[model samples]
Each structure stands twice: as C-alpha cells, then as structure tokens.
Target: MNIAFRNESLPDKLFTILNGLIITVLFVSVFYPIIYIVSASFSDSQAVVSGEVWLWPVRPTLEGYSAVFNYNQVWVGFKNSVIYTVAGTAINVGMTVLAAYPLSRKDFYGKNTFMILFMFTTMFTGGLIPNYLLVKQLGMLDSVWAMIIPGALTVWNVIIARTYFQMSIPDELLEAAQLDGCNDLQFVWKIVIRLSGPILAVITLYYAAANWNQYFNAMIYLKSQDLYPLQLVLKDILVKNDIDVAMLAGDPADAAKREALKTLLKYSLIVISTVPLLLFYPFVQKYLVKGVMVGSLKG
Candidate 1:
C-alpha cells in the first residue's frame, strides 16, 4: 500500500484551517454548558449557589441528587413520563406512516386535496378555547389519552414522511410486489416499513423528544397530581420550590438551606430529566441527518 498527499493550494488550505477552527468553537459552545451543569449538580450546595463550580465539581457531594430523589412524586412523574413518551411516540409515528404511505402513491385519489387540508392546518387552527372545549367534550381531560391522542400526528412530519416515501420507495418496486401477489397492506408492512428505517428513526426521535418534554398540555388538561409528567413535577419541585415545612422548621438556617438546595437541585434535576433522551439520542443519531435531508428533499 502507498500513501499520497494532494499538495493543496494555499487558499484551500487556509479555508480548511479556518473551517476546522469554526467547528471546534461551535462544538465547545454547545458542550461547555453541559459540562458546567453536570459539575454544578455534583458540587456542594453552597458552592453551586456561590458559582464556585465551573468545569469541575467543587466540594463534590450527592446532596442535590439525594434531595431530588427523596421527593416521592419524582418516581411517579418518572413513570408517567415514560408511559407518555413511549405511547405518544408510537401513535405519532403510526399516524404519520399511515397518512404518508397513501399520499406517496400516485394512484391515491384526492391526494392533492388531502395535502392542502394538512398544509392548511400548519397555517391556521381552531382557537385554543375551541380545542379545549372539544377535548373536554370528548372526556379526555385529566386522562392519559389527553396527552397522547391530541398530538398523535404533526402536519410537518407527515409531509416529510411522504416526501421520503415518494423519493426513496420506487413505483416499480410496488409494481413488482403486485406482480408477486403482494397486496398493498402486505407491501407496506413487510417491504415499505422494512426499508424505511431512516425516516422512522427521525420521526421517532422528534416525537419521543417532544413527548418527554411535554408540560404545557399536562398543566392544562390534568387535574390530578398523580398524572403529572416529569416536567410538571420538576416545575413544582425546582421552579415552584415546593418543600416540606416539617423538614425546614427545626433548623435555624432552614431558609438559607432551602435556597441553597434549590440552586443545587436545579442542575441535578436537569441532568435527571434529560438523561433518558440523552441516552436514547446516540442510538438514533446516525440516522438523523441522512433521514432529515433525504426526507425533506422534494418537500
């Protein structure tokens, strides 16, 4: 084997060096906050409150995580969030695929009209009050269905999936399937879906991430604390600063302790809340860029 180097022009070499520098800066800008937050989460409460921790933990301790997990509702919220994210994402992807497959087919009647209808929704919608009333009328408020059913699909995702199918799935393949006695349903389930892994991964990531972070809908539609998602629970704990008076009353520095712990918990809570999605993303990240670019090509 032999190695060779193309003697690049001076201008090209300079451009390459500059591009590398820019990319490094961008990476650092994005990564630095995560490092700071993780370090702060593990540092002592006073250190976190005083901003003494930066790239590394100062007086490192697990007090913040202990306080956060000690709250009983944290587990409940975790369970509910898992349920919502998994169920909601499943519904979202299923609906998007069902809609996109038909629209991708040239022979599907009223495709243009359906496309217009879906696109029109992106531009306008029935007012919030009406949507609320509709949900209330349907008896979905304060239920798990309220979280999953209302947002089962997005118009933008439908368009992307449709574009991916149109561009990637060939008509000749469908024709070949038909000649082999494959029905449309069998073809979609067996062939189309099997080949559509990239698009599926992209949409699954989008839906799963959205569902995990859902808070506003839970705030509006839920009346029971037991049904609250992790975001809402975190809000009450971190943002609202709800704490037990019994625990605070005995100590002379209780007020200061509460404030310090609150500061510490903020960072720990963020790490806890985002850990699932952070873990999940790397598995699907390889497909994300390719899926998004190819899916968005025609539309």
Candidate 2:
C-alpha cells in the first residue's frame, strides 16, 4: 500500500538522492577513521601493522589497553590534566567575564581604549622567547600558575562574551537590579550570570578543552614530570615511545614486539585521551550549540 504522499518531481528526487549520497560520503569519511582507530587499538599489533584492521578488529587483543593502564605515569598525567583543566578553566572564565562585563556596559569609560589595547595584543606580541622570559621573571615556571596566569584571558572569548552580554542581558534588568539596591557585583552574580547559560557553557568548554589539550606551554614552562599534563604524557607515550619493554620483550612469536607494541599503544593512547571529552560533550551539547550561534551572530 503506497499511501505515503510524495512530490512527483524528477528534479526533487534527483536532488534528494544526490544530497543523501553526499551526506553518506561525508559521514563515512568522518566516522571511518574513528572506527579504524578503535579497531586497530583492539587488534593485535601484527594485524594492525599488516593493515588487517578495517571496520572491525582483526585478531583482537587487549595488549594496547593493558599497556596504557599498566603504565603508572599515565595516572599521574591524568590527575595533573584534571587539575589544569579545572583550575585553568576557572581562571579563564573568571577573567573573561570580568573583562567582558565592563566592556559590555554602555556607561563604561575608556572602553574603546581598553578594547583597542586588548585587540592589539591579538595581532602583535613580543614573540615566544620574550613571553617565556616574562613567565620566568614572574617566577611562574615549573609551577601551576605557569599554566593559568599566562593564558588567563583570551581576546576572542572576551569579544564573544561581551557581545553575548550586550545582546542577551537587557539594560532594563540592570536598571531593575539597581532599583532594588543591587550593586555591580550583586547584579552580575545574581542576574547577569544566571541568565547567561549558553555563553558560559561555550566558554567553559573552550577553556577546558584548551587546558586539557595543553602540552606546548607545559613542555616549555614546566620541568618536573609530576607537573606534566595528560597531553604531555601522551606526547611521551605516542611520540617519544616511553614504554617499558620488560613484558613485550622475549616473546616467542614476535621479534619486533616492542616496536609493534608502540604502534598499538598509539591507538590506545588516542582513545584514552579522547574518552573524557566525549563524555563531557553530551551534557553541554545544547548549550554549546546555542552559544556558538549567539557568539557568531551580531545583533
């Protein structure tokens, strides 16, 4: 029974078919790499190296995962990463809000001058060596502040947040808050922030991701391995191949066991590093999308 309504236009049908094919191709291109990585991570190193792993694992094994879990430094890196993400994100968000709110205010004096100074920083800088020297002079090197203080606020985030405040938070609300004897801090805390979920989520995700993925800063500033973030740890494991060969060595079947293990470890490292963000994204997905829209559009 073909009871469903259909527009009997040939062009429309052709367009629909073309669109679906293009979307399918795009999805496959995006998703296939992820599937391949997962499969290769689970597959035996030999199978992975021989290009046997495809959409599914070939000669499935847990050696890669076992290596990642058994490594003690991975845990230390994970802990440090969590700390950096939480603390750095807090500093970033707080500084961004403090900067943005003043700029958003119509009565704010010298906002243009301040904005120009901030934007000027985005275009020009003292370069990396000078920045490093400044951090050293400030005694932030090899310390937690090295991660947070240097990148306390982002200019782009400030602009987005300022725009969001101007467009989203009504002046009438501020006036009402003032009428009710609310001070600037009180109004910001009680009214402005409460109304700004989308932008907050957007910025939080941005800062958190940046902190979590930060390795270059830590690599340059921090000397102690204890202070190393997950990204730095990952760089060691994947790029440097800092793995113990005690177990993988002397295996009867595999001659290049250590090299094979390194290949497997690469995939496992990627999955372990990525899983946290995958879990975190779903909770804030709606807000993130809305925030991007609000930040992108001008009112």
Candidate 3:
C-alpha cells in the first residue's frame, strides 16, 4: 500500500515542477529585455558597443546624466513638453466631460445626430494636408495654438466617456437633482462629474502622453528650434553626429567626457521622460478604474 501511494503522488509532483518551470521561463523572457537595456545604459559605451556587457552594467557612472543636463536644448525641450502636456490635458478633459454628459442623457434633443457626426470624424478625416491648410488659414500655423486646438477633443475618448456615463450614472440620480431645482450644468458639475474619477484619469493619461510625445507638428509648423518639444530635440541629439562643441564646456577632459555622456544622456533622458507618467499613474490609478467602470456603463 505504501509503494502504491508513493507512485500515485509522483505524477502530481512532476506536473507541479513542470508548471513552475514554465511560469519562471515566461517571467524571465518578458523581463529580460527591460533589464538588459537598463543595465546597458549604465555600462561603458565601449563595452556596450563591443558587446562585452550583457546582463550587468560594468563601469557605471553618472557622466551620462551630467552630460544630458549640461545640454541647454534638453532643458528647453523639457520645458516645452511640460507646457504642452498641462495645457493639452486640461482642454482635452474639459471638452470630453462637457460633451459626453449631454449625449449620455436620453431626453437631450438631436443627441443621436450629433453622436453620428462625431463618430463620422473617427472613421473619416479631412486628410493631413487639408487640416494643415486649415490651420494655416486660421493663422494657427507656427503658434502654440496649433498644437492645443487641433487635438483638443478625441472622438474615441468622447465615446468611452459617454458609454461610462450611460452605464454608471443612474437616471434617477439626475432626476433627483432636477427635482431639487438643479440646472443641467449644475447637475452635471455637482453629481455626474463627481462620480467620474476613473474615466477622467484614463483620459488625462492618454492626452498628456500624446502631448508629451508629439513631434511631427512641431517639425512642420514651428520654424524656431526654441519652441521644439522634447521628443524632437531628443531626435536631433540622437541622430546628429556633430553636436555643438560649445555644448561640452565644463571639464578639462571634455573629449572623453562627451563620449561617455552621450551614452548616459540616452539612458538619462529616457528615464527622465518616462518618470513623470510612472509617478502620475500611481496617484490616479484608482480613479482610472472607477472612471472606466462608471463612464462605460452606458456606452
């Protein structure tokens, strides 16, 4: 009987071990690339270029970061990115919330028609050239307004918000507010808006990321390098071989430092650019969950 019992348990034990191995393999495969890049970023560039450093950083130093910060253009780009993200997100959220609320209500006249019109834009656009011409015609070309106005409201965001409001917010709640003599604007502002935390947060992340990463518009519309966003500036740095020698003014050993700094700058800028969103998401992640669930209730 003892022998038979041991035999019975052996198969299950083997299966458990196999399952653990599979999961471990999956985890490593997914995480190794991220780890490799992060490690490489800190390693000596010669080691990186010669394929000497693999999984671990060798000869790690802050020279890369020092180089990145030393560049005036990087700071200028960072400042512009901040401006665009804050302004763009504010306009995007305000427009999305206001537009979605009315469409969520069943009693609103011409809602269906308006929704169809909005949806139509999502499927079909006036093409890039036409849009560019229109912007120029409106005298928005080369101006900050060119960035902010053109992408203020996304139809997809509107649809999602409308869906959330429809499913999550109760009609009876709106009726109660109405009975208390609350106007449409007041009701939306006080009641519906309060409950829409998650969806709003998601929208905020989307809009902010879009604005922060945007470069093509700046490349085309703005002639001044001073007005260039971080991504575009980063592009110039990454691609350009002969950066201004004046940019490397600090230490006496500028030549050696510049090489190491270039590699470090690549890593530092990536970290700096990505850190804001990582920090931002944790604070608003709970709201994103709530907003999506609530706002998507009807859509």
Q: Candidate 2: which stretches are off by over 4 Å?
A: 1-5, 246-254, 297-299
lDDT of 2: 0.86
Candidate 1 residue lDDT tens string, 1-299: 11222476778778878998999999999999999999999999998888788789999999888877776778799999999999899899999999999999999999999988999999999978898999999999999999999999988888888888898899999999999999999999999889999889988999999999989989999999999999998888677877554432226566787778877777888899999998989989998887778655745
Least well predicted 10-residue stretch by lDDT in candidate 3: 290-299
- Give the worst 10-residue stretch by lDDT in candidate 2: 1-10
lDDT digits (tens) for residues 1-299 of candidate 2: 13232654778677877998999999999999999998899999889887788789988889888878877788899999998899889989989999999999999999889989988998999999999999999999999999888989888888889999999898998898899899999888888888888888888898898889988999999999998998988888778877666634336466577687878988988998999888888888878767777667632
The residue ranges of model 1 lying beyond 4 angstroms of the native Cα positions read 1-21, 243-253
lDDT for 173 (candidate 3): 90
Candidate order, lDDT descending: 1, 2, 3
What's the candidate order when arranged by decreasing TM-score?
2, 1, 3
Could you tell me every candidate's TM-score relative to the true structure? 0.90, 0.92, 0.85
Candidate 3 has an lDDT of 0.79
Task: Compare candidates 2 and 3 on lDDT and give the better one.
Answer: 2
